[model samples]
Target: MRGRKELEKYWGRPYTDTRDWSIYNERLVRRGEFYLSLDFIDHWTDLVSRMNTGKPGRPFHYPEPFITWMAFIHVFLQMPYRQMEGFTRKLSIFIPSLVSADYTTLFRRIKRLDISLRVDPTILSRNVIIAVDSTGIKVTNRGEWMREKWRVRRGWIKVHAMIDIETNQILGLEVTDESVQDDARCIPLLDQVQQHCGREHTIRRLLADGAYDRNEIFNTLEKRGILSGIKTRTDAATRSTGSPYRAECVRERVRLGGYREWAQDIDYGMRWKAEGVFSSGKRIFGETVRATSKEGMIREVKMKMNCYNMLLTMVK
Candidate 1:
């Protein structure tokens, strides 16, 4: 006791304010609040509830913080769970909130999250103009069997997305095997959008490329009483006259050159936005690829997309 006091006396300025000694503590509190306000913690809690894990031990310590840390870590660093765990541990002293879970715990939780969790797209935007497109992601090893025989890649997954043209928010998303064609994926994606927006026929015009130029797609839009602003393909002539719907679209596009140009510009310009979204997702959230099974890969894809949608909701 006397020894410590003597040393303190020798040192001129004794430590008086423990709280004021470091700015990191204050920064940690603010950082945690920022993540919480963005609903990161709430989403993680929801995911954990669905996990229904029966690990049976004393239960993982600080599960909520662990999950929250994992989600934010995935988004910010865009690394796999193993890498994330290592990075966090190495840097844990700098980020107090990240010291909760190790790699295995975090990865197990991520794999347990349900792929079917319904993400509400209406939260992204209410704008009438929506852009639709699909981008490919490499699938897990189990999906290798589904790859096209002629294709060089082993297997791929397609993420069909719809974004608000005005705000660049992701209005809708669907993850499917890469073999699913763009036209085939559209109807379901549209249904999802309709359900979330709660509008019987709110989408005024859908902007898409020539890949969506089929008569059935046009008819689907027509049935919904929504205008299809998708560009008509030139090669469609082979299928145009034989089908009245294709002919009708061609005739309509031919009649309105200005409308055609406007639609093409809108479709082309907005297509890039979807690509930009994917780029941002991969760059910021590490949405690249992972699982070794088809189901796991799909789950991973949906989770990543949901995370993107959540981030969009935050920024908007």
Candidate 2:
């Protein structure tokens, strides 16, 4: 009862609109420019010449930049390859220099196109606080209708990502099968962030939820000198022989009174920025992938995430 009373003492902050309406409004308008930017047309010849140089295949008909542009559109608009083909064909009528690649070409190229995660170098140049989390994206949209009518289950793929808590930008992303566990990906995600930051020491702290409360996680972060803000499980034993780091954290939480107090001190609420990313990503790109093949599904998810990062960069 005393604990309940203590928790009740905390109240939500009053709502405030801190955004610059004029600047924010302009940023949203630029989102449309991503859909139909024609700047690639001007550099079409130069880009194609560069891509074809030292290549032993039939002279490439499309520039790599053009293919990249189409790939971005394919994921952002959630359109099928055929629709993308038609989209290009429609554009080619006015701009004769733009020859439309068929749906087959669009499929093959986008599958192999490298979509790298982008992070602000400024974030990497300083001590960083990172939040890690996983969210599932449906393998196919047909799962719902099939489940309702035929009782079929189409599982989802998990996206494990690490984001800079200060900037809320995704620094690393990995896609795995539905069977993969969240705790298993923690180190790999950290490794990616470490690679981006150029050194492991640049990561000052890591934030995550209870799914990452294992002793191995704490020990690993301790070795890297990264403070762990991972929440401890309610039933976790306060003493552990294997990982003194986790044991000490559990004891500290008790000393501080409870999870709420400990979380407040550590600013563990910042972990939810990862959830916000998932929510905004789903709302923008979608919750379901359109690809039928495993490789295609992975590439599609990466493209969606890359597009998300690009849009965020544009506003800045």
Candidate 3:
């Protein structure tokens, strides 16, 4: 097919030696059992001082830093709560904060927890190029037979996220039930990106798949002066009633050579970096949620993304 041929040609590119970066990233994790332990201690201790966890009766044994950092350890190691309690106790020599909270207290906080694992935007470059995408996250571990034979609907959550394509850093995330469409969240995801990165930070472009081929998405990008690399649906016209940018995109193809040519010109293939977000998140956090309730599932999946983004910061 012509499409297949075009893709093959487009795939060709030069490679650079990124081994040094990989070695450095590994060193970040390799320094201790708690990878980036001191970084976390410094980060969480600062966070705790500002938090309104409030004065507990008779001064609580746990420092907010200890409880919070240990929970992150829970996610990073995928350790069981009880096991992590013991693990933290043993590792307190490195970060004294780890001993402040026991695993039991940590578990209770985790179950009833509301925390945002945000990347510090102040540390980033002002240049922003965002990409948005959504992926299905399984809510249960049950197999296909359970759904097919029993006519049971499988529980699933959808994770919609926007990321900085250049740095592979996630900027914002939204978790929803399976029924929610991808396009439905594009605007909100952009809002989230702006909130996280700050309104003053300029977004240059947004890349997405055909699922984001909506007039609203195009219009929003146009108003913000952001170039859009969203895939147009096969049957969708270049002149849609709602999208003015569609006209520019059509012109882009004609001015260059063809559809694939324009895509290559703009480096639109970088959209897959958004896909990489889903792949890495699932690989690190997991493919399924262990929570039984909808709220719990949403929180777990959202936190998974948050922690995943935090890991991205470590590589910096």
Q: Write down the lDDT of every candidate, Cα atoms only.
A: 0.64, 0.84, 0.74
Per-residue lDDT of candidate 2, residues 88-136 (tens digit): 9998998999988999988887777777776666634378888999999
| Candidate 1 per-residue C-alpha lDDT over 254-277 given as tens digits, one digit per residue, 9 for 90 to 100 | 655644354544454555666788
Which model, 2 or 3, shows the larger TM-score? 2
Q: Which candidate model has the greater lDDT, 2 or 3?
A: 2
Give the residue spans of candidate 1 off by over 4 A. 1-68, 80-99, 115-127, 139-153, 235-246, 258-268
For model 3, name the residue pairs that clash.
Answer: none
Per-model TM-score on C-alpha atoms: 0.65, 0.90, 0.82
Clashes of each: 1, 0, 0
Flag the better candidate by TM-score, 1 or 2: 2
lDDT of 2: 0.84
In angstroms, how far off is 140's CA in candidate 3? 1.5
What would the per-residue lDDT of candidate 3 be over residues 1-316, giving only the tens digit for each residue?
5475575566655434465877776856753434545454545555655553585555444455555566677776678877877776777877665444566778777766555547668655676888888889887878889888888886679888888887777787888888899999999888877778776677878888888888888899898788888877544555657777876676666678666777788778788888987897787778988778898788878777767766666555
TM-score of 3: 0.82
Q: Any idea what lDDT model 1 has?
A: 0.64
- Model 1 residue 68 lDDT? 53
